[model samples]
Target: MNAPRSLDARLTEQRNPRTARIDQLATLEIVDLINAEDRMVAAAVGEERQQIARAIDIVVECLRAGGRLFYVGAGTSGRLGVLDASEMPPTYRTDPALVQGIIAGGLDALVRAQEGAEDHAGDGAAAMDEKNVDARDFVLGIAASGTTPYVHGALQRARERGARTGFLLCSWPSEALMKTHDVVIAPLVGPEVITGSTRMKAGTATKIVLNTISTAAMVKLGKVYGNLMVDLQVTCQKLQDRGERILMATVGVSREEAQRLLDESGGHVKTAIVMASRSLDAQEARQRLDAAGGSVTELVGTLPVA
Candidate 1:
């Protein structure tokens, strides 16, 4: 089978007429060329906003039904997945298992090059099965080239077992690979800053795309409120302070009053908002939040404007 033309790879090719002086160009000229291509990364992602929004909605649905989100990739893509997953626990106070990342060379792949590990497509399939992926789950295989055997094999197995399978590739749509996946998201951010080093521009594009998908989906899942990460953990005093401030500003209560509600709600921003605005106590606040499906917007949405 003919390989798919790398849509990004084609676009990012240095277009200026090659000259004998090309080898003698100054470092700044090379930097300028790279900057030009890097500037297009955001535009590529922006063009796919609607598709990204759809992916977010689907991810939220999976999590709502007690499912997990898994990211499988090799090399830079794998490392990026690991980095994003690692941040979730601290940033959003979510369970570590809720969003997991599997790199080609296991945890070691995050740092050093895992040569040949990506070629083991069977390893990718094994990882998915080990995770016990279910229909309620979403698995996204990210590969800048769009033809990573490791990711393709995982997508194939993920589909066969009934999990919603998605692919994030930088290549033009290749039917051979696309047919194996359910959702195909190709944000063709053309090429790398350094020839084949996808870690540069391609990786940046993938990271931005992943961040958007997960964050937007979280918002849909009621994890965010008025641009605030309401689900942020109050385990730290700083977060607890932030929770108090959010409650006071959102509920229009005094600083002291918001702190009181925060203490009553055990530092829960959602509960504190409900308790302060609705004049309900802790238990009632929880009941109200639960009824609102954990959304502060919905609960306060019904109250008269202060």
Candidate 2:
């Protein structure tokens, strides 16, 4: 009889028949083959659209309740989580603590490979404790194989602490895993081009999912106005220019006037629009924005032509 198959024998770890002889392929052929494999990632993620949307709602709920969203993972999974978390503060002007990433090996692991760090379940639990995860917080564990001890331990401890937990896996997880997480996002990107190398397709899928979740949550929080990132912090020249452009396009103002409005609103595009539309001073515009939940459209009711 064949021996029992371990978790590594799962689909994500299995070989892809399409790229079986990739080593023998020409340079151009290899690129074409890799691109073909990448084409499937989006559709796989699309299949989990409902679950991804639900995850976003859970995150939004946690943030609205003054709680935070945490992403726990190891290796490539961990890196992607950190990348997404780090970008949110700059992109949306949200507090860094609002969205956090906890890799198994900590900051040092970010640069070098620390594969051994993922073995300690106790350490994973300790990280959750340090973060003070509670009922209001939501923690999402990213594990390509759905079997990372570090991720599993973190989610388990997070649940024990009354935190909402979710799991993002590249494989079809067992029934126990499905039951454990409040949300399970399985993109099922299938096997990698280079067998067992999850950093390829799995990494791309994780990036896409993280992007969608954070972007949607920010939108729901009114960090965006239509398709524009209105809550962006003007800490640099590029952002200042973008902010001015947003004001000019939204309110039909000249570049100079947009800069003036931005100055009045302390470089906040949303507040600048409110100030311009309602003929209010910076303080009154901020008050109206706060009252209207920082929604430019709601605060102004209707736009006024230049």
Candidate 3:
């Protein structure tokens, strides 16, 4: 039987016959070679920083305006999307539903391999419908070869319905599949040291891209304060301690006074800063942050550093 026409079936332009013999090397040498190649991934990503920043700006705007962010993929690519979506709530206090992931085989794929799942295009469409996805959000698809059925299906459908689309895959310019999205970030990391096991190089690239997408988007949404996780969860005592310190340092209040204002603001870090720095009450602090669009820095960057 002829193989399916896929981005995978497509040939890579880099012709390095030496890499095919990578396994014949001593184990240590092979590991060293792989590690050496891995270093190039960051440089590739660095070159795409502007593209990454643009995606972040668009996604963050949707999020703050009450829109959702969706990730779609298959296999290792799918798992990476799930991992990023799962982390946002705990790390940045986002509503879990607002940031979501849809893998080809559903949640079971995260634990065990679901090889057949990748072939089903209907699964991709069904998953998006199940989530009520629409023009109000953004969809970022992941397909290392830039041609996973599930990823392409999602992006195509997203565009059909007026939802903006973006892609994080391993490809280059002039690939027309690249043109379907508002932004295309194909961090061309070439091939895997182990060949066909995209779970290696391709997976690493996917994770790095997802990390950049979510973290930078959150930062643009005012979820960060001068590199500190200003929007970090206050569900634990450690977070409570950190929040109090942020209050003290940003407001220039004595430690004792900072704690007092933190208590007064009900342990909300941004509000506490407003009270300590601006002498505003909890209600007033809330208003100030709202007025500043949730950016503590914008709300108080003019204040003397603590």
Best by TM-score: 2
Task: Give Cα distance to truth, residue 52, candidate 3, Å.
Answer: 1.7
lDDT of 1 by residue, 1-306 (tens): 543444444433422232223457798987776677788889988887877777787888899999999999999999888888887876666799999988988998887899689998898898888888878899999988776889878877887778998888776867766676667778777645545667877788899999998888777777777787777767887887788777766877888887777778887777777777788899998898878888887877743444
Candidate 3 Cα errors over 4 Å, as ranges: 1-18, 172-174, 253-263, 302-306
Give stretches of model 1 more than 4 Å off: 1-31, 302-306
Q: Which pairs in model 3 have colliding backbones?
A: none
Q: How accurate is candidate 3 locally (lDDT)?
A: 0.78
Q: Write the per-residue lDDT of candidate 2 for residues 1-306, one digit (tens) a residue.
A: 543333666778887888888999999999999999999999999999999999999999999999999999999999999999999988998999999999999999999989999988888899999999999999999999998899999999999999999999999889999888899999999899988899999999999999999999999988888788888878889999999998888888999999999887888888888888889999998888888877776765544444
The weakest ten consecutive residues by lDDT in model 3 span 3-12
Q: Assess each prediction's global lDDT (C-alpha) against the native.
A: 0.79, 0.91, 0.78
Q: What TM-score, over all chains together, does every model reach?
A: 0.87, 0.95, 0.87
Model 1 clash count equals 1
Summarize candidate 3's per-residue lDDT along 168-260 as a digit string, tens digits: 877654558656678888787776675567777668878898898899888888878887776765778888778777766666677788678
Which candidate, 1 or 2, has the higher lDDT? 2
Which residue pairs of candidate 1 clash? 8-190
In what order do the candidates fall by TM-score, top score first? 2, 3, 1
lDDT for residue 51 in candidate 1, whole number 0-100: 73
